[model samples]
Target: MTLSAQTKVGPAGLISDLQSLGLRLEDNEVGVTGRRGGAGPSDHKAVSLAGRTVMIPIATVSACESPFVASRPDANGISEIRRNGVVVSHIEFPRQPRFYDLQTTEGIPYSQIATLHSSDVLATTLLQSCIRYGNRNTSCQFCAIGQSLSAGKTILRKTPEQLAEVAKAAVELDNVKHMVMTTGTPNLTDRGAALLCESAEAVKAVVDLPIQGQCEPPDDDIWFERMKAAGIASLGMHLEAITPEVRARIMPGKAGVVLERYMDAFDAAVAVFGRGQVSTYILAGLGDTPDVILSVSEQLITKGVYPFVVPFVPITGTPLENHPAPTPAFMAQILPQLGAMLKKANLLSHDMKAGCAKCGACSALASYEV
Candidate 1:
């Protein structure tokens, strides 16, 4: 069922609102298995409506159950999104990727190496185990990286050859456009930069896919040039929370890196990868006000960095799992401001060679792009 773009509320606003509130998945048999790399436990599933595809959170502790969203198989595969018994819109879920089925010659499951993200991006946590994950004093309060590994969903480490093979197959089978490779911080200084370089080289040898390598800032700034030379078209150095209070309270282990160090790394990365290609994830509602978040975003934009501010999603099993997600109004207040700033800087997500902001599925800020 096609929806009329002109609704009581604008279509983009509706998407931003739904993503903020989170959709209630009722009897939806088709969905992706929840991954443990990031802040949230809610499954990253593709939701299509209003001529666009957005990845929304579902089947988590924080998901809303009141305004139920169900896929009616009996109704010709249409998804009805309801608000108090009235159908507001019909949505569709994307089918699972083909690459999940095949394995490498050595019997490693392809999915263990990497998984499909949104519709066209392949993302993987290159090293599933983080040095800070087990140490409570050091761990990021919102991280669940070790949870998936404990459940046997992914391998401990992916070899460069294995990652290369998986990348090639995902591209050939699903027509994947870009790939994102993120890793748990191996050590305070290692930060997976060396591993990412090897992985990118192997993947590029077999296929010509644009790749983004995400890691904490490395000790040496020269790693940025090495990453770019190794076929990493984009780089993501995420500061999940901005303020020092929030950082020290939430991600104690990572906070030791200091905010100033990350800014320096951003400048070096932008110089190597160019402006829009360097991005960071500043998660809102992690003890920062809308104004506070916007202020940091402004500073980041001035340094030729793309501040991809995302709303915080509480994941089950993490310390902050019970923490409240940011309200729709707060998101509504901040996203447009950030989007406008991005527009003024001419740092469009569309111009990003490859990365999360370019994918624009996890956050609704892209919906507000002018």
Candidate 2:
């Protein structure tokens, strides 16, 4: 049983509670286009609960429906979210982005280059192709990078020129606050940092939005400095799983990078980006115990890197699509401890200038800290 605590049921808390529980929606295609790539499902849609917008998993593979949370439209462009059988709150879906309508002179849709995430952040995969995505032996078993590109939902490589045009339109038309550019690992030694740096340069020339570039650690540490010089305000080097065994099991190809190397890279990145600006993705419940997650998070905190611990929702079409998300009680047991650690270290997500740690829709850790 969850050891119930007397917690305040405010807006952020309610959104946090719902995202932790997952949300079942009457329609998944209404709001932002859910971008699923090498990351975990990424199938959640944005909802306005109590004035704040959050990304709640509504199109998960394992959870076709959530027991505690569900939403349906009411009259007057409003939505009612029900708990069990009672309506607990009213939520709103953001209107479709205006940038989605326009296209470049080359006839490429603006949205095909990048799209709005949550309510304000702009995000895209600079290179949708990855070296490790071809087969199970090298592939991170959960990656769907090839799925959308294979179906032609997005293009292969978004040139710097195309990205700049899209970024400018997204900012002027949609009021985008920040930009996040993540790329699949290419065969080159620079991984995708070279592409991210070029993309960041292009976007910064066109708009003044803070940008975050996500990639595996580059072959050398200097790439961090080059990336910062290119106008990327923050960096994300993800370690989707915590334990060595879980790393090998869920993502053999990614497991080759090894935790020791990631730690060294984190040290290098923090030195360049300073504290809180360097972050990593730690997908909770891909088989890591709560103890393991908290322990690793502590280590990451010590290095000045933010541990963006998010629940692992099994994406449809991936190998682990049948796997279960962490129990709400598990997240409850962990968030408080992680929150205390972050507070003590002064590594709050808001200190981050740009990217997922600041936007913070996929995870509820930011709300937990408050």
Query: Best-fitting candidate, measured by TM-score?
Result: 1
- Supply every candidate's count of residue pairs whose N, Cα or C atoms clash at under 3 angstroms: 0, 0
Model 1 worst lDDT window (10 residues): 32-41
Per-residue alpha-carbon lDDT of candidate 1 for residues 1-370, written as tens digits (9 for 90 to 100)? 4544444667777777676667776664544334444422245457677767677766456675535465553435557777566677777767778999999888878977888777799888888888988888999998888877777778889999898889999999999999999998887775899989999999999999999999999999989999999999999999989889999999998999899999999999989999789999988888988998899889999998888888787777788877887877888889988888988889889999898999887787887778
Candidate 1 TM-score, true structure as reference = 0.94
lDDT of each: 0.81, 0.81
Report lDDT (Cα) of residue 117, candidate 1.
Answer: 76
Name the regions of candidate 1 deviating beyond 4 angstroms.
1-6, 28-42, 64-68, 74-76
Candidate 2 local lDDT, 102-169, one digit each (tens): 99998888877887888898889988888888788878876788777776667899999999999999
- TM-scores, all candidates, are 0.94, 0.93
User: For model 1, which pairs clash?
Assistant: none
What is the lDDT for 306 in model 1? 85
How high is the lDDT of residue 319 in model 2? Answer: 84
